[model samples]
Target chain A: MQVTRRQLLQAGLLATAGLVIPALGRTADNSKENLLLSSVTDKDDKNWWVLSDSQGNILAQHLLPGRGHGSARHPSGKSAVIVGRRPATFMSVVEVSPQGEYKFTDLTSATGRHFFGHAVYSVDGKFIYTTENDFDNGRGVIVVRDISNDYKVIAEWESGGIGPHELRMMPDGHTLVIANGGILTRPDQPREKLNLDTMKPNLAYLDTRTGEMLSKHELPDHQLSIRHIDVADTGRVWIGCQYEGMALDPMPLVYHHDLNQGGLQAAEASMDTWRALKHYTGSVVADNQQGIIGISSPRGDRVTFWDNQSGKHLQDIKLRDVCGLIPSPNGKQFVATTGKGDIAIIDAQTLAVTSESRTPELHWDNHLQVLA
Target chain B: MRNCLLILILLCSTFSHAAEREPEAYLKMLNQALKLIQPAHQLFADQAEELHNQIGQLCQSPSEDSLQTTRNQWRKTMESWMKVSVIQFGPLLENDSRLRIQAWPIRARLLTMGIKQLETAEAPPTLEQIAQGTVAVQGLPALEALLFRTDALSGLQQGQACAAAQTIAEHLIVLANTLNQRWQNEFGRDFADPVNTPGGFDTPQEAFDEYMNGLVTAVQQIKRRKLEDPLGLAGKPGKAGATESYLSENSRDNLHNNLTALILYLTGGEGYGVDDDLIAQDPDSIAVLVLDDRIKGITKYNKQLTMPLEALVKPATPEAEAQREVAESIFKELSLLNKAFENQIFEALGVTRDFNSEDGD
Candidate 1:
């Protein structure tokens, strides 16, 4: 019998209350339960992939060869892949068993390409698509890898712009929406931006089956590098930008693109709110059940929430160096992680911290993923 | 169960004891820093007002002496700004006031466009009109362009250009005055009494972290943006125009004032400071020792930079190459200072450096 997340949450609560249910314990294996996954750097500067429970307790951890960025969970719910940060050459695949044991397989980047720190698995979990940099050619490409064949490259296609950072498969499973960050960099220079004066960032929707570009929508300002995105259930694409212009210039850091409307609209916020974000948004996530979208500004040390339907600013919560954000397993709360080694569970409706924990030894990275 | 409870109580008391002592030290340091900061802002406002008065005289009399007087006042006002620009928190960051006061490494094209628009307007632009205009036109850079540039110096004599200069000076007075008043009033009181006002920090450690982060960022801006990028010490091609205060030829003086202010902040002028607290915590702290050494290194090299930074970067001249070497030495010392803060000082203080502040996407 398959157990749902709601059932597990209920069981965990009952156990916490000291109520003994013999049959429930036999059926629900506590060791197999996982809540969230993130890449963490310890005080020693070593990197690890950490899986934790809802209460922020570490369930399992595996060391990575290098620092990892965003992660993709397999549809089977038994495995996940961690990609290295920009100009990265390694990727690690982690498989977990029902007994809570973990296995790891590492993959190397193809010649003349490096991972841009994000990837998404196909709906069937048969293939993974990664955003990569064709640095020598000064272009971005999406490489399709077959999961069953040692994660080998099956095909490749243009990412519709220069520096694609993150991509997600739409609900339909065949459409991939990509955030082309639009800042060019060569491998020799690595993190230095090569094209700030003329960077044109865009949101591109591609037909995965035929490798054809469906539509591409560019931001109004060429200096706003579209870096991260999330798709709401209502078919709206939420974008987070890192501005490359003068720090004093006022620019909206969050935008949304509606598939039906076919253009990008800035999320409405006051000028002070825009300044408070400090011109960089590290992550964007949508809580469909709560009808709210969240954007984390690590530079501002705050997380801002917006109403998904209207694209209007709702509220702001102060969390020092917060960047990683995701919906809770029950879909009623936001599980946020901070670079200062904090994890907070925020009630979606009230926007208050219901619970929080700190691990002083570990610094969480930019993006968080549900373990599935 | 009784023994376990006893042990827990003992642990709690020990943790509480350390936590209680830290806040007191932080408050002392904060109070000293504010003493320096509050007065600096007032001087900045006063300097701006004097600059405005001098510009008015230049417009009415149209003499070179008055023009030179206004230019000298502008430099004094810019120095005041550089001293306090190291402050990266509180009212300075509240409404983009810092940018309105001085936007540096300015876009020449944008500044030209803004001045042209201001000069060619049908009527004299009001303070409200200038305030609502682009930040490029409303602050010190605009005033600098109007007062110092060869083509714009003529505008100080008469016509719409004189009107634009007077209007921008007026805007600077307002911006400077607002900053001064805010620091002297609620913000200053709240900073001094963090426990009662909370001042957006739950504990004194958080406030200290913010203060340290500001100092770290100031050092970074000095090294990377002000020196290395313009001087080509960081592997990028050198560009003289990239230097801050390039047109005013006050770039070296800007560095001197910034370093002096940083030293005041770290040593707390005449009162208790981070150095005192660190020594009290550990008499033989390595962080404090290394920090003082780096500070000495910066001062030594900074004094050696006799020429303006723009002239130092010009290639193929022996004197320019010699000056570049001096600038490079200062950059190296700054790099070490930044590392001491990130690695040693923060670690000694048990402050967790946030990853995003250090490395962001």
Candidate 2:
């Protein structure tokens, strides 16, 4: 029987109402290196689109719950899991055929609540890690699921932090990292309750298998929120925040971390500290290959480029409400999206807009995925 | 197998189609609501600003006469705001997105208070009025804050909220226990006489109705008492109001009971047998499904739902407003569904069955 993703979820729910118990396959961990790269609409409206790269062309489509706010390719490059946008729910598997057909299997709903940013597939491709908002209870839970059986949940963990939004599996393979957004809201009426009492963003590291919180590095209390994050191949994690509402007191914050004797210590700010950056960061991608890291703030209408080697702001591109940004597989082009749903392709080297496409049907084209 | 697959495809398609259509429908509904309220909001904002300035001036002068003048103006201004702001919840209830309706009571209360506070020396509001407004504004947000505190306290295990949520959970437990005792001591009858619903006994609607009304009243009283104490243990150092810590504790204690009362009543006498009629089947499942569908449906039915709310709240976009509307509608429907579900559950226990039937009638 070809069980649909929703059915799998329903069946799983029936098995256990309170806890999500996953269905495990016998050979679930067997290595399958065929990764699919196809752009399935995480959300639709043509102008605002999140694309997945196949060879050189971008396949454009919208997902039902909407486009992914974040996506991570499986190392084998055959499949990828995406963290789709709000009222946060599921992590969908974007399966690519050799022919490049996109089939999405609902992997797991956000146990923590709504998912915001990227979902990273383990380097071994055995598991997928993602972050989510636990709105019902007013916190965040970090969920890890096994993709072996089409997609079934394996284990789940909590961030021990409030509002864990984005996640990336560090290149170290053992460490699963998360951005613990420090915003507190009433569990039920999130809109009304914005209590900043115990608010403090943290970069949390956890064990992939045990779901044990290994280490937590907290940021200054003043940094509004640590939301989206990217981990470099060299094991450096770059973090970003969506400063507390439009009043510029809390501009977007970015910092790199180093594990030291006192624990994870924040490295000195690499570039001119961004003091006036407004609702600026939704996407952060650190390019290990190109030696540059990119941070895009669609609300700020700018994408700041940083020279990873020198730790400097190379340039900034203004794309209003820029939602997604990812390097092409060949490392020659950078693909990005705007809230208005425009796809701006820029040269990897010059970082200049080479071409732009619009998806009129797309409303909130959020994150991008690239299958190598 | 092929037929099964076909049915599966049909179900999936139906759901997706429903999903798409639901948001649009919600948008339409909201747009209409926005049209009805936009003029009023603008007027409310203007008048509110002016009254606020006047109140500020009165606060500076500090006299009974100035206070009386400010108070009188506040009352007049408040009356105007209410006239302009009172949402016809009937339309929201009837619309695809019922969740949006849930916030109306709360938001209405806040706006009312915003206008009320303007009268620097108006006659003190009756305890009943204060209690009602405070409960309305504080209900969901307070519960949520407690939940978040639970996570912090419980150490992020879904169970963490249990400790703080315990206070609320305990209250729920007490309500369930009391209702059980009432049935045993007085009625000594099965929750329902039994008509044909899935579960044999039903929470006699009368009993369930009384239970809910009394519960709201009792809740209001507690809130009033809470006002007297203000902070209790969680009181702030200098602030007269409750401290976050104390409020968290209070919410924790109270929320559990509320939820338990809700859950038990929703379950239809399966847990304690207070009223079989309250819940017929698994109230939780039914409530969740209904809430899910309503939320989804409201989003689809946006045209009717979004306009009025947009006009009222003045959110950034039609879609964002629609999202909020659907969420509200889901929660509101869930509250009603939850009550019904509890009635189903309690009815099975054959206790306090007829207590509330007349009230609804």
Best by lDDT: 1
Report residue B202 deviation for candidate 1 (angstroms): 1.7
lDDT of 2 by residue, A50-126 (tens): 23222222233323454345667888877666665544465566565665455656644634466644577778888
Q: Label model 1 with its docking quality class.
A: acceptable
Give me candidate 1's TM-score against the actual structure.
0.89
Model 1 residue B234 distance off true place after TM-score fit, in angstroms: 2.0
lDDT of 2 by residue, B183-264 (tens): 3332223222212222312333322333333333323333232221232211322222231123223222232233233332
What TM-score do all the candidates reach, one by one? 0.89, 0.45
**Model 1 per-residue lDDT at B336:** 86
What ranges in model 2 sit over 4 Å off? Answer: A1-63, A107-117, A133-139, A185-193, A245-247, A250-252, A261-276, B1-361
